[model samples]
Target: MLLLGLAACGGPPAAIIGVDGVSTRAVDVPGTHLLPIYVATSRAASDNPHLLFSGERSDDVSYARLVVSVPPDRPVGEVTRASTLPPDPRRHFVVVAAQVFGSEADFVSSLNRDLMERPAPRRHVLLFVHGFNTDFPSAVTRTAQFAYDSGYPGIPLLFSWPSRGRTIDYVYDMNSALQSRDSLLATADALKESKAVAVDILAHSMGNLLVVESMRQMALLGRFATADRIGSIMLAAPDIDIDLFRKQLAPLPVGDPPIFVMTSANDRALALSRSIAGGVSRAGNTDPEKLAELGVNAVDVTRVTQGDRLQHSTFAQAPEVVQLIGRYLGNDGNLAEDNDDNPIEGVRNVLFEVTLLPARIVGGGRVVVVNE
Candidate 1:
């Protein structure tokens, strides 16, 4: 009933800004930035070009490439989509080009070609995994917004699972996420084979469950052979049970690739999730100390009042928070040292101060000191 009421209040629009919105001509428009996003999905292909992929789970994984146009006027931490069918390139975030890869090999080859264009240090990949109630287009556009906002120069890869994209279908989304674990593992294997120097992962909400489970599977199978190649992992607003999260982390080797979990005590979405889980505390909203005991960096962002009313996406939607994330990404996931050249150094200087404590806390939108 609570989910139904929230759904009625209207969340992100469900409009399908299909492949029809793809325009090569849009790339030439003034002040438009083009961001290429490579996609690997476990969702079934749709006959509709507007929705290249549907929410139904697929037996096989599919690969595609999408180039999204970020309008010059768009805010740094926000993604503005087209309200109507024919999206305006100059004013709206639209797909400038789209391509479906013939095979996984072809996708990796294209990715390598892109990586070759960058210098060695910048030749990395940021893989994003979306949470509940996300569709294909939403995932692509969000990835573009994140990449552009963070000023990430590396490859942006999206691993999309079949999400029903309906608030009332939370159970369906969870099951679908679990079902896509094998596919996610395969995607990780593909990244390991790519030319990328490192692969940094950012998983949100229920997506964290899939990521942790995949890592657990890899651990069970002794697949951490390329653990060094895996970079920092940021789990933002994870929806997994706190106890279960601890259990999942127990199998994997600690600190192979640093793990950071962003949490907010005031996250209403996670509150609802807790209720849905029968009052079990969720990792994203649990006490930072509890999370730190598991050997992962727990970042408390309850003081950040900048996101939507739900406060579920403060990690990405807050300008200050996003800038901090950008710095962490650029610094190879270590926020212990200060970087003078970073554009957001002022914020970083004022926000984060390394301490010997067990957890980091961001308070009043100003202090974000992390405990190393």
Candidate 2:
């Protein structure tokens, strides 16, 4: 009868939503906005191939859900497309409760409900963007896990860009990532404009470039009312050229929403990214010399290594990243504070600021203690 969930927005109208007679709705809350999701399938376009996860049901397909128009109960316009129902509706259109996310439109709306209705006003909304060579499923689950690891599983939003699921699809995926830039910007603008939502973006690898480029466009177009709402940007294994990042910073002129860059010298993928992308230095190669010059908060992640590269993608691949992310979520470290401050220079570990313990200056071997 009535499926009440989080939200409704863009794409196509008449979404099948995996179920036979499904509709979308938009829900709002204090810390996040719940966007509507519909589970449907689109005809595979030439450039766009279908994405598959081995563990998922065979019929599930990638679809976008939205609430583009509203007219009370008059069958208003929807944000996404309407495709034929899949064989398995539950698997095709399972509702997720995450940020500006849309596997199901009500996912965000539902998260809002859980936060304000069930719990309290949600404090943080961390948007996780996955990088190169990842399928849609890998991106979603890992992001959810990342939030779980950080102990903020109830916060709203997960942004997984459309990265082709493959290793050799590097250039193609890079270009594909480039294509999605505009949409990400649109989403960012929408979130910023939403009076009820406070947004933070965590973009990894190619997704970092995507979010940056989107922000740059917003900055150039003077979409700062939109830009300013961006709470913080945490880039892990950023896949952009160092020069490109500076240029991007120049245009956007970071002020409110600070930028935090996490790198790892041990990251072979970034080394390869540097080589293949033609001298485009990545955050993975960030050093004390270049970070401040580039106007980024460089957090070295070399010492925080854990999982297999997650398709050569860093950031959420390690458990420590989750802790670091948790610290950032608390909104303690400002990018201005981290500028030129290489916390890792002396020890060479994954460096980020935490409020729990005071700075430990290495005075001597075992004599090191917190600054008194």
Among all candidates shown, the one with the greatest lDDT: 1
- Model 2, 332-361: lDDT tens per residue? 344223223223111113333332232222
Cα-based lDDT at residue 105, candidate 1? 93
Each model's lDDT: 0.79, 0.47
TM-score of each: 0.89, 0.61
Question: On a 0 to 1 TM-score scale, where does candidate 1 land against the true structure?
Answer: 0.89
The most accurate candidate by TM-score is 1
Model 1, residue 88: displacement in angstroms?
1.4
Error of 1 at 208 (Å): 0.4
List the lowest-lDDT window of 10 residues for candidate 1.
Answer: 363-372
